[model samples]
Target: MSGTLRFLLASWKVNLASALEYRLSFFLLAGMMFVNNTIWLFFWYLFFARFPVVSGWEIGDVMLLWAVSAGGFGWASVLFGNFPRIATIVSSGQLDVYLSQPKPVLLNMLTSRMSVTGAGDFAFGLIVFLWAGDLTPRGCLLFACALLLAGVLFIGVMAIAGSLAFWIGNAEGIASQVFGGFISLTIYPTGIFRGAAKVILFTVVPAGFIGYMPIGLMREFDPGFAAAAFCAAAIFSACGALLFRVGLARYASGNAMTMRN
Candidate 1:
């Protein structure tokens, strides 16, 4: 375990060095993320300005949802940015080198790239969340847990989507579309969703678990729901890991001359 940690640290250092080589590009990327999310926030602000509330949810509540979802998604982007590119790696036979490595292939894939641009999103989301309201001590604790669980579930879903590349051969578009749909669903209040849609989001897509369920727990302080969300996160993460391992078994290297690292 210690050796694996050391290897990951070394890999992160290498990735950071590579990122620093393109310092200007990195800064530009971060600026773009900040602007993109800020625009999203402004859109919500406009909606609230016009109506004052949407289905009983105030602007502040909506901001809280954005903060939880964006913050969680941003963290996942930094930690699992390579997920969407897994298809490229597999199709190009780059996964062969990872398979030959001593450390876990999934861990290697995770550490392969680190996007600092996501840090901007994380910071902005957190600032919006904090500025939106003054929470009690208990609310703060629950919010923290909800944020952590949402991050876990987000990464797990991405892993599952990326694993589909093994079978589909080209999964970038599918992954993006699927995650984009989830983001759309999250931006709105879950109450707007109906019986069947809610069921589907909770089970098949699990988008509701990302923000809806967590926010529900935050509003009502339902320990049972929070427990269920945590359990669901574990189940999804385990399923994703199992799926990756299954896909790894079918990986075939296309390049004969290039050696595994």
Candidate 2:
């Protein structure tokens, strides 16, 4: 366990160094992503200004929602960048390189890359949290827990979606669509949706686990719901790992030459 943790830390360090090698490009990409999130928040701000509340959610709730969602996503992407690109890697036989490594294939694959824009998303989340989220001791603690749960859930869902490549041959398109929809759903207040749509968010896409975190976990502290959300994240993560293992057995090798640093 210690060895694996060491490897993970080393991988992150290497990724950071590589990203810093091209500082100007890194800063530009991160900056653009931060601005992009701000613009979306601005639109939401305008809507809330006209109507102070939407389905019981105020702008403050939405701000924390983005904070948890974006912050969670950013940390996951920065640490395990390949979570979103598993389909492409599997379909292209990129698993060959990971298979050759002494480390666990999934862990190695996840840590092999880093996303520059993720830094922007992470920073944006922190800024938003400071601007609009609860600042009490309990509020901060709950928010931290919410961020962790959100990150775990995101990685788990992406892993499952990406593992489909082993069966479908080219599941990249499907994975992309699922990921896009998941992110889109997470920013909005779950209360806005009625019966079926609401059910779908919790069961099918599971975005409700994240969308409702601000209210259920941070703002009000619903113990029952928080427990459910925690279980949901754990279940999704375990399911993803199981699916990837099943799929890896059928992975095929390719003749294309490749190298990794």
Candidate 3:
């Protein structure tokens, strides 16, 4: 466990160094994403200005929603940066080199790169939290928990979508759509979604669990919802792992040169 953790740290160090090589570009990308998110918030501000609340959600709730959504995605992208690209990697036969390595293929592929824009996302989350969220110790802890569950949900769902490449060739489009839909769903309050839509949010996509956390768990501290959220994350992660491992059996090699360790 310690060795794996050390390797992950080393990989992050190397990624940071590489990102630093083009410091200006990195900062520009991160900064641009931050600004982009802020612009969306401004639009929300306009809406709220006209109508003070939507489905019991005020500006502060929306702010926390963005924080959890972006922060969770930020950490996932920064750490396991390859979650959304798994289908492309698998379909393109790029897993060949990773398969030959002594380490875990999934871990190796995930940590191999860092997302420069994700730094801005992470920063935006913290900044929003400081500005809008409660700063008490318990609130901070719950917020952290929300981030963890959100990150896990993002990675797990994306991985499951990507692993479909083993059965269907070039599943990138489907994965991309899922990614888009999940991101869109997470930003809105779950209350706005009704009946079947709400059910699908929790079951089919599981975005509701994430979208609900800011209200049910983090802001209000509902034990049942908190437990449900944790279990959902675990289930998604397990399912993703199972699918990826099963799919690995079907991996086919390509023309790319690969070194065997």
Candidate 4:
């Protein structure tokens, strides 16, 4: 376990140094993404200015929602950068090289790349939290915890979606759609959804668990719901791991030339 952790750290160190090579491009990409998130939040701010609240939810709740959504996604993309691209990798046989390596194939594949824009997303979250989120001790702790849950959940769902490539031949488009849809669902207040829609949020996409984090675990501590969310993350993580194992068993090698760099 210690050895695996050391390898992971070394991998990230290398990735960071590589990203720093082209400092200009790195800063530009991350800056643009931060601005992009701000623009979306600005629109929400305008809506709340006019209406004050949506279904009993004020702008503050939405702020935490974005913090969790963008923050969680940020860490996942930065650390497990390839989570969303698994379908493309699998379908294109990019996994062949990783399969040939000594390390865990999934872990190796995930850590091979790093997303520059993820730094922007992560910074934006902290900035927003400082600006609008609850500034309490408990608030900070729960927010951090929520980020962990949300990040793992994001990776888990995308991994499951991407694993479909093994069966569907070229499931890249499908995986992308599912990932995009899941991100879209996460920004809104879950209370805006109800009945069958809510069920779909929890089951089909599982965005509700991420969406509800601000209210259930942060704004108001709901022990039962928090425990359930933790359990959901565990289940999703196991399911993704199981699906990827199944897919890897069926993974075929390609004749394409490969290089470590």
Q: How does candidate 1 score on lDDT?
A: 0.75
Encode model 1's per-residue lDDT on 14-94: one tens digit a residue. Answer: 877876788888788877887888898899899889988666677777788888887877776666656656666766677
* lDDT, candidate 3, 75-154, per-residue tens: 99888888998998899898977888778888888888788898889989999999999899999999999999999999
Using TM-score, give the best candidate's number: 2
Query: After aligning candidate 2 to the native by TM-score, how far in Å is the CA of 154 from where it should be?
Result: 0.6
lDDT of each: 0.75, 0.91, 0.90, 0.90
Please give the TM-score that candidate 4 achieves against the real structure.
0.97
Residue 194 miss distance in model 1 (angstroms):
1.0
Which residue pairs show backbone clashes in model 3?
Answer: none
lDDT by residue for model 2 (1-261), tens: 999999999999999998889999999999999999999999999999999999999999998999999999998888888899999899988898788889989889999989889888988888999888878887788888998999999999999999999899999999999999999999999999999999988887889999999999998899999998999999998998899999989998677666664
The lDDT of model 3 is 0.90
Angstrom error at residue 55, model 1: 3.0
Better of 1 and 3 by TM-score: 3
Regions of model 4 farther than 4 Å from truth = 257-261
Q: Residue 13: error of model 1 in Å?
A: 3.2
lDDT of 4 by residue, 68-126 (tens): 99999999988988899999888878897788788988899999888889989988988
